[model samples]
Target: MTDVLRASKFSEWKEDFNWDTCLTGREKYGNFLVSILTSETNGHVINLNGAWGTGKTELLKRLYVSIAKKQHPVIYINAWESDFINDPLSVICAEFLNQLGYLLANSRPKKELVDINEALNKLMGSISKVAYIFKLSSLGYKAVTGDATLNEEFDFSQTLLDLTTQQNSSSMSLENYNKSIISSMLGNQIDLVEGMKEIRIQITSISHILCDIYGCNSPIIILVDELDRCRPDYAIKTLEVIKHFFDVDGCNFLIASDTESLQESIKCIYGQGFDSERYLRRFFNQKIALKKPSLYNYLLKKGIDFDGMCPNMTLTPYSNDNERKIKLLSEMLNNDKFELRDIERFIQKLTACIGYISKFNVKNAKFINFCVLAYGIYEHEKNVNIFKERTNKMSSHGIHCNGYISNGMSVSNFITIHFKMVTLANSSKRYNLDGGWGSCSYQTEMLTVESQDLQTRDWRREDLIECERLIQNYRNAPNSFLLWEDYQKLIGLTDAIE
Candidate 1:
């Protein structure tokens, strides 16, 4: 492999999404979503549902770019990235104003732009007050304002004396003094409902301005990604902010997340019996589930060269047919329910094992299969005892067992039996040969085996006989046998590479 390909193989894969680079054929779905979002005049909330690592972020990015190409105003917010902030409304409002400024950068008539800016300022002010109210309710008045007096127990005589002192100095009335105290604690004197009403009017004006700048059919599309990865409070609050505040005409929302995970988040906030599904149903107009890409297509896009990983392996199961290797690997991944992120890690570790094998110039078919099986088991179980237990099953049952029967007996079963036989033989020495003749003494050196409790079942007579036969067959060709120590070394080598 070239240096570029080697670096690309182990590095994190970031999709640079465009219509031409959409390998999973999801651009068609993107176009369909665009049609739905643009066809409506009123606001619509779309829940784009997909499990983690199913490419939700890429789909949302593609949709954002596609909508932008049609001269529509769009904003993409990563909710996971912004969940550190206490208020999701603040994050959304900041992004909205930034994107809106960009959209109105070169618009005609400076007076209309000024009017839009004024309306946006009012809108932000209204949102700030609402967010402040939420903070006061959750964090307490003293925590928000840092005013110790607000938290102190009220004293009627002391309070009256303080008010009288202020009244004497500034000629302030008792009513005004009470209003000042309320304003100081609340951060604003406006009623929350009145403030919300003002926000709605300002949003209406801004939405009208956006329609005038673009077209009557154009609406501000806000795409929120990774909502499921956020904290439960942050995730639920984001949904509430979008539904209650931004549910105006000419404003649409496309939130991409695992709806099931988000539902669990809702349950976390409202308790187990809250009917989270019904709550989500009230926010979204439609829920569209994204289909996961096929394993073949995903690997092709990833550009994995299995042939290059182990070249010149005439004796291997997949030497002549790389497609068969891919098929078997795909079956293993699907059986384990490997997500895209898990698949990437598996490939990285497998490549590291192959790299270690290449140092010894041992790229045969059996060794290649051993590397694949070893890493697959490692990725799935991450326990040596589990690996030995599975291998032991292959020894006693001849690979025809329930879990070992997949991908046919030739490829899967043969590899398991081969792995077990080699490791068992190499695990310990058969004898300590020593002889004495007259005054001279002779001692044969024995290989020192590392103590490992592999948790294998008791060996049967047939298993020992097979182990002895295989050990003697490969006595002169030790390189053909991969020991348990060698497997451990291979796994250790992968840690550094990863």
Candidate 2:
């Protein structure tokens, strides 16, 4: 199965509010929200706002399960998934009826359940008929005015004339007569008004029945998720349908969305100058924003074992300590901001690179570290020249090996020193002039000075010594050294894996 399907299955089994695997500490917040939802007896609408990939959907699913476990009538609706349907009311009403049926299955006597189901079905049938009439009238108007393109030509004018002739025997002009027929067909909106009132009353009765069955005074909780991910018209229509048809005395709505994106969607439908925030204020009683998870904790929860042993240990002669690898990588990434999705993509790419490198048995810690830094820079800047420029800057600055040294060096500084040391050591060569060989060696002098500097800065001595050893090893086996071009090749090879 795909990861999405697997996760969906897992979410079904893991619905309790006190989940052991919730690393972001959201379970406590879920409990708190559930308490507030259950204590309220009147109709309410609460908007849960968070950025994309901030676990809004997961939280909503958990909330659905939590409320269900408490014997409260609750329903979960994914608005984006159902946005393809033209009417949001039908989608919502269908889900509501289905969930209510499931909740009432064994709670009531069979005859009572059948009677309640029959009543609900009858009310829904009436509502559907009224809704269908309104839809036909709307489509008729659109067809007549060329607002909606149809496959065949429509004789709406003639149709109106025929209706007018059939209804009246008095003499009347065709234009005024046609307007009268059209107005009576389309502009007499009281049918929908009366239909909605009936729907609200029926829903209020159903919700009260649910309250008695569930033994709770709270309103039925309806969760609408991913509203911002839907089409502009669908999202707006969902809010309107809920406010008009489902806003009864015993219903509560908790809409989970990225409100900023939802606001933009509203602007798309109602022009750029629309006051979307003020308009949204009419639908929601309060808005709650979810807290974003920390990067380290999120990574850990996503199954990144930073402290575990390095894989393919036999492929390389380096120590099998993965903690150092994680430390260096965390230092490199800690200052940057990444959404949860971006971090997941980064981890996927990193895993692919490590897997490809393992095939070549090139598991040197420094090499892996460079791969991490290169991919990070590429992701952020979208240009390899930034990597080259940093290295070039380090070269021009004379490799300041003795200027300052510390265990807590910034990633930028560490990257410069690390790459420069490798380049200087690997570039050492001998030139033959007039049949005599002369050695041009600056690496030895730089290493000597760096060693002396490390003696004074003993706190980071081990880290600096490890860097010197890597440089020396690369100098001894220059073929194993990875230049910028080699790093690019590695990246290219792994890019297709994801």
Candidate 3:
């Protein structure tokens, strides 16, 4: 047995949401999102917007699972994955078809599935046409801007030839053929701006067939996750494709992203001073921020575990023990550099360090737990070993951090004096620190010490004061619980630790 807390409790834990717990605090918000999807409408584009790691993806997933009973077919597309592909149309086609296959899995008759497959292939041809138009437009852009190193005139001619040859099986010329279809969709004028209309018709056809095949009258709900983490072009283009092409009457889109970053991305692509938020607003009719979670309750519910401790101590709240710990945790976390995820990290570290305490005192569990978390928050998790190693160093090399000299000021005295205050605090006891161990705090009557408590076999009169000073400082400043690297930093040593 390793006598150490299993690090897996917090580090490897994921926030798993089920129907009952998913709506615990967010019942209204969950209902609001599902209501929008289930509302009588042709379709919708809803953005679940928030800062990075504010649980936007997690929120969307909850919505995804919760909406199942709403009778809507859902598809989750990780739009950040668009980075791997260069062509926008190909990216959309791949994500949509991959998820569509799953949604329609074994739902249709064999003959109908064959027919649906043929219809899907034709829809893919329309997608290929979309890719072709994009390629042509890129060449046109290079020619217009004179930004191409290659000869644009030659490239354009070669591209046109390739297009014509590829479609020569048809009677009409390639340009006339595409224009004829576009003109039909637009009723006369073919503004490439209205290119959306042609693709919209094709996508609508696909959605209808998909609905019949998936056996759902409700709209197909497509949840796009991790949009903000994608590159600027990919993120913007994916949104555009969904709006213009995939905005069919029977399909809905729920996109999750850091809306601010998406706005910043628009600014980056469209140039400074452009209203990126306005551009985003045009795409998303409704936006909801992910609900913020309470850090204290979240940690408490995690049920902090310590394997090397006495029974009945892991996060079992005593007489206001949780409150005391929460108060200190709040103070330490006042600086927002540590997000919810970061706080969970320190809580895990605290549980692990508490496992290493020798002669564990169940009475002082509250105070010790506070120091464990405080030390972890202020320093690295590996620094938990510093207490042991620092004591060993003091016993061997006579290095005292108390800024004083004393005979028989052994490591045991230092360890004893420090944990004593913890014992006193948990037990509602105090003693004088004016001339006692003042390492953790500078208050008189800070901790109680009895005659029997003072072990002088390897201690001295001066050692008592020095050890008290050491413990007081540690009590006052959790940063004093320093690892070896911190020591090297204090001494300006650049050499790596062995």
Candidate 4:
């Protein structure tokens, strides 16, 4: 294909840049689901939790893409944007029916509804078992009474109709029904909803036949993202309904949420007295914490050739191609016929001027003029005295930046030292130059030194103070366990992995 190099404002932020692609295959999260799908153990539900912008969605998306391509039917739904305002069971039922309707519309028109509903009911039964295992399943319990044995005569419709039609339906009967039928039989035991549960049960009973329409091998996996956005009651109730109904029937569920929110949501449904840890343990078997990469490793990974780059180059490149582009710019500026050594010498002097003036209350315009004059010597044939004259003019202006050091002792000498040190400390590989990283002491002292207007104090003192505390705390208290823990968390994220 011919190279197309069009440029426009709209294209600037477009995904076509392919910034997110990687050259090699990185680690995948497929192992987490392997056991859930293959083992004879009870079906699994997992919550992939993390902070916003931390790559939870991306990881889930990739995992879904991989698993689904193998012919396992995967359905993705972002609950954060869904309009599921009804009972949790109703939402699941609606989704199942919608999917089943699509699956069976052409093939089995006659038995479509019946097959689907029967499958749904069986699946719901499995969900009830899971709920019972989890505890706090629901309020209803079943028992035998007049007319017939409870299992034989106590079906959902009759019980719901009996509850609604008989004006004298005792709360005791409702309570018993909850214990025997609702608790033992149905998964999302919402039967206590002021006739709302009964209503849901009736609807679920009628619509559940959709599950049978799906082929036996065609199990569906529904992925729900951003449960963290739901109200606690809504979020927890939704989770329970999913566990009891959907998860029970051989359908798989993957939830993307904030762990804290999911915990709080469960608390709301099962009551604050519920053991939050145990409740969470039921759904999430393992947790993967995610965070941003450390600055030091991040910069090094960009493959910066720091020693070849100018110390004053503020527009740092994030990739190798950008670094080449910058090197080209550097070479263009050098071709003005200034000796390469002279250019380096002038930058040394300029850095000194910047340090001195930055400490004082010099006008920005004057600073700019000084920089222009410093660089003007390259093109124009200015003698050494003129350079000295311009340099002396700033002394009375309160910039003590006039002295030229013997290579190692001046404030100007330390400007590059300081920049390189900070860069290396953040994410660069190592100190870029030879001589054993000797500039570190000078850099540290320079960093601590107060400038004329105390600009350093205003800009960086609080941050320095925090750093000092961290150092002191690290020294006096415990081990570096917390630091290592945090480091591990940073790498397990999609942002870092991608």
**TM-score against native, each model:** 0.65, 0.69, 0.56, 0.39
List per-candidate RMSD values in Å: 13.9, 11.4, 14.3, 20.4
For model 4, the stretches where C-alpha displacement exceeds 4 angstroms are 1-27, 31-42, 83-86, 99-218, 264-275, 283-498
RMSD of 3: 14.3
In candidate 2, residue 361 scores what lDDT?
Answer: 61
- Candidate 3 stretches with Cα past 4 Å from truth are 1-17, 20-28, 109-195, 210-214, 306-337, 356-372, 375-498
Comparison by TM-score, 1 against 3, better one: 1
Q: How accurate locally is residue 120 in candidate 4, as Cα lDDT from 0 to 100?
A: 41
**Candidate 2 local lDDT, 177-223, one digit each (tens):** 43433344345677557667766775666666555433544578888
> lDDT, candidate 3, residue 305?
35
Score residue 42 of candidate 1 by CA lDDT: 81
* Model 3 agreement with the true structure over 469-495: per-residue lDDT tens digits: 445544665443332323223222211
Worst 10 residues of 4 by lDDT: 1-10
Q: Residue 435 lDDT in model 3?
A: 28
Which 10 consecutive residues of model 3 have the lowest summed lDDT? 1-10
Count of backbone collisions within predicted model 4: 23
Identify the superior model by lDDT, candidate 2 or candidate 4. Answer: 2
